[model samples]
Target: MSQDLFKEINHAVLDLQGAQLQTYERPLKRLVSLLQHPDLETYNAELTEGLDLETFLEESARTGGSMVGSQRLLWPDSAEECLGLTFLLLQKMGEDPAYAATFAHDFYYSGSKIIAGIHSLTGQLIIPFIRDYKSYTQSKGSALVALQDVRSRKVFIVHGHDEGAREMVARFLEKIDFEPVILHEQANQGRTVIEKVEKHGDVGFAVVLLTPDDEGSVKGGNLQTRPRQNVLLELGYFIGRLSRDRVCTLKRGELEIPSDFAGVVWEDMDAAGGWKQSLARELNAAGYSIDWNVVMR
Candidate 1:
C-alpha cells in the first residue's frame, strides 16, 4: 500500500475530538468497515489489544512532547505532523488485525491514557494513510480534464542566453493568454519545488536559448550547452511519456539543432526585436491562440 495514503488518514484521525469527531464519524465508520472486512486480511494488525489513548492525548498537547500539539494544527506545517500521526495509525492496524474491527467504533471514545499508550507503542507516527483522490480531482476542475482528453497541447521553446528570449516568452505567453510555468521560476527550493512538481512536471514544451558559435571550446562560443543538455533531458522524458510532436524547438542564430532534436520543427527568432513576433506566429500556427499585438506591446 502507499505509505503516504496511510499517513494522511492517520493524521486526520488523530485530530478527532468534539465537533471534529462528530464530523468524521461517517468516514471513520466507512474506513473501519473497509479495514475490518474479513476477506481483505492483509491489513489486519494491532499493536495493542486496547490502545493507550491517555498518553497519546497528553503527548499531543499543545505545549510539550516531540510533536507538540501537531495533532490539533491545520494546513502548511500541520501537513508534516499529520504525516507522523498517519504513520502510527497504520502501525497499529498492522500489529494485529483480529481486534481491529471490534474497536473500530469504540476507538473514538477511548480516553486519553489508552490513546497515549497506543501512540507510544506504535512510535507515535504510524498510520494507515489513505489518500483522498477526490480532493485532487476537484481542484483541477473538469475543463483541464477535457483538455487532457483532447489533442494533448504542449509547449516547447529553445532557450537562448539573450535575456530577451525569457522576456519574449513571457510576453508572448501573456498575449496568448497561456500561463506557461517557466523552469527558471519553478526551480526554487522548499514548498515551491513540491508545488511545481505537482503542477507542471508534465508541461509540453520548453524555451531554450541558442548562442552564437565559438571554435575555442567544446561548447563553442555562444552555445549555452549546459542549459540545452538539461532541456534535452527534460524533452526526452516528455517525449518518452508523451509524443515527439509535443516539443516545439526554437532557435536564435545559425546554430545546428542538436542531432536528437534535428527532426523537430524549428523557427528563427529576430535578433533585432528578439523572438517576440516570430514566436507568436509559430505558436499561433500550432493552434495556441496568441495575440501578436499584445505580445509586442
Candidate 2:
C-alpha cells in the first residue's frame, strides 16, 4: 500500500513540473484534491486518538506552541505509526515536490521510524495537507498567490553608472514577470532620492549592482574599483530594513566591498555561470513563488 501511494505521489510531482498550467488545470487540481481523501482524516484520528487534547493544548502554549511537544503529547502507537508517516510525507511533498522522491524512497525502505524521528526532533512537519490544497487553488493564475501578496512581485533595482548592466537586469526581471522598480524611471517629483526610495517601500526584494564607477582606497592604501557611494548607501539601507536575505549584490567586475560585508554572498554578473538561476533562488527564498520552468524558458 505504501509503495502504491509513493508511486502515485511521484507521478503527480512529475506531472506538476511539466503540466502547462495556463492552458490546462485539471491534472493539478486532481493532484491537489487528493489531499482531501477521507483516508487522511482517518489517519489523522489514528495519530491523535487516546491523546490528551486539553493537556496538549496547554503545553503547546507553555512551549511556545512547539509542534514537537504537541506531537509527543499526541504520540501515535505502533499500529497508528504508518498513518502519521503518510501525513508527514504529504506535507513535505506540498512544500517542495523535488523532495518527493527522496521522501518516498526513505519511507519505502525504513517505514515509519524515519518520520517518527523527524516528528520528535523538528516541529516543521505540522502543516496539514489541506492547506496545500488551498494554495494550489489560489496559485492557478501565476503561482504568485502562493506568496500571498501582490506587492511581493516587485523587485527594486539599485545600480551605479552602468546603464548597460542595469538595463540587462531590468529586462531579465521583466521576462520573469517581476516588476523592476528602477529609481531613475520612477516619478521622483520634488522628493529627494532617499524619500523616493522610502516611498517605494512595498518592494519585496532588492538587487544592488556594484559596477566599477569609482576608484577608492581602504586605509589610504592602493586604489581599487568600487561602486558609487550612493549605491553602497542604498545597499546598506536595504540590508538593514529588508534583511540581508532579501537583498542581493551583483558585481560587474573586481569591486571592493566593505570588510564588514565579508560574509554576505554576492554574485558576479560576468563570471557567474547562471545569474538568472541565482536571482530566481534568492527571490524564491524571499517568499516569492515563481515557476522557474516557465520563467527560465
Candidate 3:
C-alpha cells in the first residue's frame, strides 16, 4: 500500500513540477484525489506525531533543549507552523476540489504571515514536504498529545458566508451568557487565519455552521451544494481538537455532509429557531451552566 501510495504521489508531484503556475490546478486536483486514502493519512499522522509540542519538548531534553532559550530547541517557523494547516487544507480540497480554490490556498509564503499572492504550491510546499516525508516514512515517531481539559466559557463559532445564521448563533450564545468568539470579529494582530486558530485553541466548545456557500462535485457527478472549504477545514480541526462531545455542526440548507462525520452530532439550522434549543442541550450536556429560562426565551 505504501509503495503504491507514494508511487501515485511521485507521479503526481513529477507532473506538478513540469506544469506552469497557471496550469497547476490539474496536477493539484490529481494530488488532492490521492489524499483521500485513509492509509496515506494514517501513515502521515504516525510519522509526524513526534512534531507535537509535548513530546517535542520532553524528547528535546536529551539534546540539551530543556531550557527555554536553548539553541537546540525546535523553534517555530513557516514550514513547521504550516505543516498541520497544509494537511488540513489538503483534506478539504480532497473532499471537494471544485471548492478548493479557497484552500489551494496559495501554497507558501516566505514572510511571518501567509499573505495572498501567487506562489506555486507544487514547487514550494508539496515538493519539499514529500521529499522529507518519504525520508521519514519508514520510521515511526511517537508523541504525547496533551489534551486540553480546561473547560472554557468561551464558545468558538465557526461560520461561512451566512451572516444571518452567524449573528443568530452568536447572539443566542451571548443571551445565555456564553462568550461567542467569531474569527472575523477577533483582532488579527497581524496573525494569519491558521495562526489565529492555533492561539485560540482553548475554546470550550465549537459551533460550526455548515452553510451552502459553494457548489461542487466530481466529473460526471451532479453539482452538489456544500459549505465553504474553510468551514469544512475548521470543522475537521475542532472535531479533532475538542473531540465529538465538545463540538456541534449546525447544517443550514441542503448541502453535502462529509461521510466521515456521519456519527458526529449535527442539527438543522432551521428558520423557525429550533436549533437554539439543540445547542443549549449540547452545552448543558458538556457540563455548561445552561438556564432553561434563557434558552426558552
Could you tell me how far off, in angstroms, the CA of residue 61 lies in candidate 3 after the best superposition? 52
lDDT of 1 by residue, 140-220 (tens): 322122112112234534343556676766666655666565656555555563354445655534444454432222444
| Model 3 error, position 137 (Å) | 51
Which portions of model 3 show Cα errors greater than 4 Å? 1-150
Best by lDDT: 3
lDDT ranking from best to worst? 3, 2, 1
- Per-residue accuracy of model 2 over 1-297 as CA lDDT, tens digit each: 233543454344333322321311333344544554554454455454554544533453453333322222233344234234444544445555434434322322222323222221111222222233233333432212222232256889999999988998899888888999999888978999999989885676799998999998969699988889999889988887766656888888887888877877798787543777888766654445567895567
Alpha-carbon local distance difference test for all models: 0.41, 0.57, 0.65
lDDT of 2: 0.57
Q: Which 10-residue span in candidate 3 carries the lowest summed lDDT? A: 109-118
Order the candidate numbers by TM-score, best to worst. 2, 3, 1
Q: What lDDT is reached at residue 250 by model 2?
A: 86
* Model 2 clashes, total count: 0
TM-score of every candidate: 0.37, 0.53, 0.49
